[model samples]
Target: MNLKLEPGTLDDAAHLAELRALAMRPSLERVGRFDAERARQRLLQNFTAEYTRLIKQDGLLAGFLVLRPQDKDLLLDHFYLHPDFQQRGLGSATMELVLAEADTLGKIIHVGALRDSDANRFYLRHGFVLREVAEFDNYYLRYPQHVPLRGV
Candidate 1:
């Protein structure tokens, strides 16, 4: 199926609410009924003039990608395709857009995922180099790119 990555808008807040509810599952499983509302609030704080996007397949909110709009350096945050959409290459396409945009703008990007997350492996395979572990109780994994990856 074809995919679309379009800029997120205030209108998409409800979809975000829906996604955040699902997005919290892994964290909730780890932390037990974690406060996703709080997480959403915290996440929203990071939203700036950056051009965020709601990933769509056939015009549905299949997933989303948010990165710093101006910097070559970006934080790929809250990227999740629905459970039904997972394993369907939608996530990959979204990420490729992130990298393509980075490469176009001549910037590097960095992100941290949970150490045990499948996303960590995905990032590694996508040219994100493991740089360091992080602080905080959960001890996240840090991955970084200094430029468009050499081999693609």
Candidate 2:
């Protein structure tokens, strides 16, 4: 499958908000925090075209990703794939790109997953180390892995 990350636009907010609601519903519901309106509003409030990307699979919109650069770290803020796209390796492939960007910038990556969400395992598998357990969320960090000089 051909995958690409295309820059997002302000006009894409509404559509993306709906996508976020759909993508997060299961985990949110599992935690008893499912509020479609709240999910959409939260995403809309922080939507940044500069940091957002529309994930395309074979020329169709499959999901969205939001990676923001903080002082010395990068935040994996919002990553959502359509229900149909889940468990299809697209998320992993998208993560590889995100991680590569973090590696290139030598920045630590931060992400949070809802308590009991499958995403927690996904993050851990991709080298994220659990650092904090909040009331409803689990935070993780991934430090950049630098290659050592052959002779030093």
Candidate 3:
């Protein structure tokens, strides 16, 4: 699959919000938090076109990613792949790019996955260490892999 991340825009918010709701439905329902309106509203409230990216696969919208730089680390606020695109390595590919960007910036990456969701495993597999476990989410942190100096 030809996966690419394109810059997002304000106009994409509504569509992305719907996508988020759809993509997160299973996990949300499993945790008894599946309110469609709430899910969409939550994303819309903090949506930032500047930091969002539309995940497209060979010209079709497959998902979205939202990475925001924070004081000491980068926050991976949103990452969702359509059910059709899940388990096909697209998420991992997208994560590789995200991790590379974090490494280049020398910043740690922080992300939170829904409690008991498969995303927890995905993040852990990507080198994110479990940092905290909350009521409904598990937070993780992945430190950038810095290259050693040739001569010091």
In model 2, the worst 10-residue window by lDDT is 143-152
| Full-model lDDT for every candidate | 0.66, 0.94, 0.94
Candidate 3, residue 27: Cα displacement in angstroms equals 0.6
Q: How far is candidate 3 from the true structure (C-alpha RMSD, Å)?
A: 1.8
| lDDT by residue (tens digit), candidate 1, 26-75 | 75567454676765675566654245678889988787766763343566
The candidate 1 region of ten consecutive residues with least summed lDDT is 136-145
- Please write out the lDDT profile of model 2 over residues 1-152, one tens digit for every residue: 79999999999999999999999999999888999999999999988999999999999999999999888799999999999999999999999999888887889999999988999999999999999999999999999989455589
**On a 0 to 100 scale, what is the lDDT of residue 144 in model 3?**
96
Indicate the residue-level lDDT of 60 in model 2. 96
- What would the TM-score be for candidate 2 when compared with the true structure? 0.95
Model 1 stretches astray by more than 4 angstroms: 31-33, 69-72, 136-152
Better of 1 and 2 by TM-score: 2
